[model samples]
Target chain A: MWELIRANKRNSIVLMVIMASVLLVLGFVIGMVFFGQEGGFFGLMIATTIWLVLTLISFSSGDQILLSASRAQPITHEVHPQLFNVVEEMKIAAGLPAMPKIYIINDPAPNAFATGRNPQNASVAVTAGLLARLNRDELQGVIAHEISHIVHRDILFVTLAGIMLGSIVLLSQVFLRGMFYSSMGGSRRRYSSGGKGGGQAQIVMLVIAIIAAILAPIMAQLLYFALSRRREYLADAGAARLTRYPEGLASALEKIAGDPSPQLATVNKVTAPMYIVNPFKKAKQIKLSNLTSTHPPISERIKILRNLSQGASFNEYSDAYANVTHKKTIVPVAALSTKEDVPLRQASAEAGSEERLDKQMRQVGDIIRRVNQFIFLTCACGLKLKIPPNYKSNKINCPRCNKSLDIPRK
Target chain B: MGTSILIVFLILVGIPLLLILFVIGIYNALVRLRNQVDNAWSQIDVQLKRRHDLIPNLVETAKGYMKHERGTFEAITQARSQAMGAKTVSEAAKAEGALGEALSKFMLVVENYPDLKANQNFLAVQEELTGTENKIAFARQSYNDQVLFFNNKIQMFPSNIIAGMFGFTKRDFFEIEVAAEREVPKVSFS
Candidate 1:
């Protein structure tokens, strides 16, 4: 895992450098177009300053921005006891420093993701849809996957990389729009017809600027997407080892992927890769450069998980991954957590099938309801008042009886 | 000529620097492995202590309904104290196994009292105890796994070189010896 972290760190640093250079180059062309040749150096300096400042800010609080962006609310032990127990269990299994703060997205898209700089500061966010969809074992599998991301330090690199990627995307979008509006305003003629020495050179620079604006974001995204489909599989392997039940995760993958819901309400291009399954309901096989995709196919991941033979230990996971992916030893030798792999848990007997499903869904609903903070207050007039968790009023008037009820702080 | 001279100087300085870094990295890695073993052992220790703490609650919960199960309760308490007193890994394992045996027996006896099963507090405590037991089992497995990794690191080629130079020795596994535990058939069919 240390080795994987080091490699991911290297990958992120390389990607950042590439992005900054792309920005500098684009700035130079745009500068030349606007202010002639002398502005090239000035533009590079400005770009460098922006990159440095943004990188620092993103490094410090990228996770917070992501959580807020998803409209996630912080969850506690009191909100969902079973969820806390599972997270605690996985933390113990992985030997993490601190339990990752759990968050819940109100959207019903059935996806989960992890983000932070490291295990000590990490947080896991899941859609309320996930709680309602998955069973206990499946939830364990998914949480274990998120924990693996934290353990491998994938969250740090991915979050930081995500920041740079977002910046490039914004820069491209704004630049393209500016160019589009300028051409519409007859600025193409302005460059060719006047402006003294800016005539021919300015046209050339504008054309280059247009190309850079068009291509830079795509290049940045390709870089982000190329960041080891291996890492996702590695996390899958880690989840399997943590849970000792690959079928748990395999079934979860099927459910999350096969759900016919629309995209998550809050997910955008930048935050999409952070999720276990893409929150965007896109086709699984959108191969961009023919070599990699944003994540390995969900089916491929589930197959690799289901292929575990001896048990869910790291070595067995490696074998299964190699067999399914046909890639040898993507996991580092020193980082290989080769333990005695216990066999997958036997399936529970086929009794109380309907009751069990009901029980599971009710448990999920109850957990979601608790997390959502619906305070139960039954009035003297037999009126049940449902108060939101975020309600801050000290007193409430019961509609039925006109009796005042004191609301205590949760 | 100047560039060639600089290249020669670079090689002279760089080779030894790289060698030193490699040695340092190996030594540091070995140190990390040792620390991980210790960390894994503490995980087991924590879970075992949690199991110990929950035993009394279970006993107390069952006390009201299970009036005639005095001998079973006594055995459980005895095992718990013995486990608490255990100092070494082997001692802890043996003592914990005995405690597990006593607890399971007590559970079986409590089955005769239908009301105890229905008691919400007893049920919660019972569930919690079982959860702790599973955690302890996994923690023990993972600790032994850590020990195996540590041992392998020492026994391997390059890391073995560092281990020998640093006086790192193999540690013992927490071996449990009991009838029920012994019957858990080997999982690796291959």
Candidate 2:
């Protein structure tokens, strides 16, 4: 998993650099056409400068922006001690440097999301319905899945994708405006004067520019969704690894899938893929098409998890996902039950080793107490007496008695 | 002059459009990643608080029957205090670990006094604690997922550029390093 994440990090850096250069080249091209070579160079520099500034602002205040947009309310330990404790537990488990602030949204939908630029500044928010619905193990599965995203650095990819998409839309608008403005020029100025080939070339370039403007955002969206889906699957596997229980997450997914609540009011297409489950609602009993969906089909995901319980490795899981693109079989609700509830005995046995360790510690504490109870003796002179186990070899002392005394080990 | 116009059109009009689109894309992506992180943490917080709230009730119920086990009671009380007073992730983890240790001890003491285990109030508290433990696990899972998303953004490429420029850094996953920390007594040797 670590290796995979490391590779992803490397890939993302290259992707970002490529994206920046692409944007810079585009800026330079625009500048040259409008104002000549020198103007083009200046335009490129300006665009880069603007991008740098925007990136800075986005990084610093992104979390706060998300929190407010989600309408999440900050909670104290007093207001929600259970949530605080769970966050504390995960922070230690994940080796985070600081506790992320906790928030709750009033929505009844059983959904949760994490926001922030990084670990220290991160925040997690969940709807109220999720709290009322999920059991302990299922909930852990969900939380672990989110943490896996954080650990793998999928957030960076998603953020960059969003930025790229936004830029594409803005540029398209500008292009449309320029096209409209250029069209208003007088037709009397001899179309033939520029020569046939040059006119053709001009037309072609304009076509290419318009097409690129239209296609870039679509391409970016596809890439963004692709990344989101892959990360979700990876997170599921990571969550299983973190909790050491595939069933927990599988069950949580089932619950989320079963819930029919509409997506949160604040969520839109761009933000939808980041959620644990797709927050949007489709027609009940309607199978999801893989081509259009932001998430992997839920039924397929459940199958992979069940396979994991039967000892399938993640590589197999991925392979299965890749190979099987058909509409998923709807496993009966009974089958869901079988996979959902982990038996108490199994849970205890899984926890048995630690329980034994705790027992041993308690026994040691008992022994220490018992030893303390019998180790001291009183002197007739009203001073405490101390003696070695081997009274003949070591002198016993009684301040008042001025006599050696014997003592025994408890 | 026509060729120049063509070249000029390509240079002047085509590129800025693309750059604007790219910026918008990056911004939206950042917003989404940030939201996921927030959601994940909230899940964890809710579960943790549930666990915390349950402790007092558990402690209170156990108090009456285990009257003779003052040391166990004190340990639990102290552990709760420490857990509650904990201010940082690591500190809370340590305090929670201590509290778990104390809680298991208290449960062990309750074992010798079957009456305490059988008490309606004690059973209710225990049931609630167990439920809270499950919730805590769920919340942790969700928090970790968001952490994964946020960290990935700060660590990954193009987003990392924005992430670094904006001082966005990788988030630490709230995790328990040792399984020993979560251990509760399974006194049912049977």
What lDDT score belongs to each candidate, Candidate 1 first?
Answer: 0.78, 0.63
Model 2 ranges with Cα > 4 A deviation: A21-50, A180-199, A283-292, A310-410, B1-57, B64-190
Candidate 2 docking band: incorrect
Question: What digit string (tens of lDDT, one per residue) describes model 1 on residues A240-275?
Answer: 877787888898899899887777999777777788
My TM-score estimates for the predictions, one after another, are 0.82, 0.57
Q: Residue B28 lDDT in model 1? A: 92
Candidate 1 collision pairs: none
Q: State the weakest 10-residue window (summed lDDT) of model 2 chain A.
A: A336-345
| Model 1's TM-score against the true structure | 0.82
